[model samples]
Target chain A: MKYPGGIKKQGSSSINYANRGMNFEADINVTNSYYINNDIAVIYKKPTPITINKVDYKSRVDAVITEAHFNTPSTTDYNGIYKGKYIDFEAKETKQNYFPLSNIHKHQIEHLNKIVRHGGIGFILVNFVKLNKIYLLEAEKLCSFIESNERKSIPIEYFENYGYLIKPKFNPRIDYLNIIDQIYYGGKL
Target chain B: MKYPGGIKKQGSSSINYANRGMNFEADINVTNSYYINNDIAVIYKKPTPITINKVDYKSRVDAVITEAHFNTPSTTDYNGIYKGKYIDFEAKETKQNYFPLSNIHKHQIEHLNKIVRHGGIGFILVNFVKLNKIYLLEAEKLCSFIESNERKSIPIEYFENYGYLIKPKFNPRIDYLNIIDQIYYGGKL
Candidate 1:
């Protein structure tokens, strides 16, 4: 199979999923690089956990993992320090008008909650890809919505009301720290 | 080859190095878990980066990585929130009297320096494994030493003068955070 730009795709649904996931993370990675290069903030995406099953040793100093499997992460995807404050978040993208709550795992939500309780900034960046809209919703607000409503998904209206819209840019791409400035520092930046 | 306690050696110096590294990190993990369980702090070691070379899919949802290699990390190992402050640090163990500065990469030192400049706490935990001595040396102190000294290795006298000794405990093992409290909070705790 071939994807756009003449890149051959391995015939696997998992590869497609992996590619899609990488796109979102790659955008954030570029944004983080811009921030780091500019001395603005130091944030990083945590690498995905891989469980090694087998390793082949070529020499005493050289070894290659021959088999491994992806493992679930216990924390959010991204976290770091911003202006001396602990900044933590998870980024997800959805094509639907309603964001499914199941898109986030229970442990991840708990981790976010704990961050907020520790006086660290915690939020979620939801990219409505079809709508070309990005929203930064506080972890507290998401938790409240989940606790109060019996709905399995959060409507677009809730995000519009409570979440801050992050405008995309050319160099930094997502410009999420702009939203952070508004939310945490009273738009000082 | 077989190691003691019925554990089989993986017949690779890299594996031996990995096992030795994991022993130090595992102790820190247990300590972090203790702090987390006690609501003292939330710290975690970032997962290692692995470059995936090939994947084998058995089903639509299942995929196994067939070939991969470990990649170098851009930042320090451990980071988290402690008492509403961002804490970042790297841990290194040495068997010699003089700790070699080459053990830390340039980029990692830059990362630690950035963390300090941004008003976040950053440090290095040096464990003299042979002597069973763990020292928590502040990032600024380490940077100044590196910048001022012409030598490639930091002598034990430097650590004795500038670094706080972290006493090992029964439950948490490496209680470096205790030194952190002493350094940062005027020993209030």
Candidate 2:
């Protein structure tokens, strides 16, 4: 729920609410940077898309966007390479015990499936903030749960049983890549 | 350069200039989509980043960005999985005989080098728009040239010698993946 310094707040009341939503993403960004700096991996979160409607040309080198709107991303938030393998995943934070199915879009699920089909590693990082637990669940399991029609929300117990737990670290914050090494590479390195 | 239909143009005066610049990207997007639809590959171009300065909230779901500026990208534009291997590259179009090194940033070059060091496939797709020639040059060769300090721009002769020429097709437009298969896998498939 902690907010980073770079994100600007508008209207005093909504600051806390916005920070809580952005904390998970910011933490992952920091973790990825740590990995990159240490030569472990080169994962990165894709930037949020913004559609520009108007631009004000202040100078030849400075064109400021006057009006814009957020655009929906066509793929997952995070993707990169680790040990010659392509890694793709989406991270979601949920306050409830059950993760809502609607948090993920249909195309993103399809994209994850396609990645797996193409022989790349694809998964989801689910953060249950209330309980301070994060699980790295493979995309195959998530897709299966989606197809089974068991419930609208996946219970926390299901993740606890099927997914690998990612231990939060002080240096990297959320060390999800370590969980990746354990699950994908069998902790070989 | 021929412009595609999907890209939105801001004004009439800027249309020609914008379209010319966007053609290469738009063509690659079509080519990627073709590959995706045919179950060949799952490559995607990362969205351009925008730093938000101000926002106007119309409703709970309708928050519009009133002010913003373009943010510099930290890595290459296109990346994805191809045959279980991490594929990463940057595409650039130039009208001159030599490709200017300044067209690419220092961080992007560093990012490409990192990908190669971690056992991933990395390269640059250079398009000579005036000549209608596209070449897929491996990152190792590009880095070597960069390290050698031979010239500020990469001469066309070097690309013709070390790079793989990608033949434009009617269906996919730029069939760079075919060249990838040929070079990376010895055209076994």
Best by TM-score: 2
Residue-wise C-alpha lDDT for candidate 2, range B9-74, written one tens digit per residue: 454333433333458888899899998999999999998877888999999888899888888888
* Residue pairs with backbone atoms closer than 3 Å in model 1 (clashes): none
Per-model TM against the reference = 0.87, 0.88
Query: What lDDT tens digits, residue by residue, belong to model 1 across residues B34-60?
Result: 988988899999988778999999898
Q: Comparing only chain A of model 1 with the true chain A, what is the TM-score?
A: 0.85
Model 2: residues >4 Å from true position, as ranges? Answer: A1-22, B1-22
Q: List model 1 lDDT by residue over A34-111, tens digit each.
A: 999999999999888788999999887677899999878899999999898999999998889879998998889999
CAPRI rating of model 1:
medium
- How much lDDT does each candidate structure score? 0.86, 0.85
Top candidate (DockQ) = 2
Candidate 2 residues A12-32, lDDT tens each?
Answer: 444333343458888889889
Q: Quote the lDDT for A189 in model 1.
A: 36
Q: What's model 2's overall lDDT?
A: 0.85
RMSD of 2: 7.8
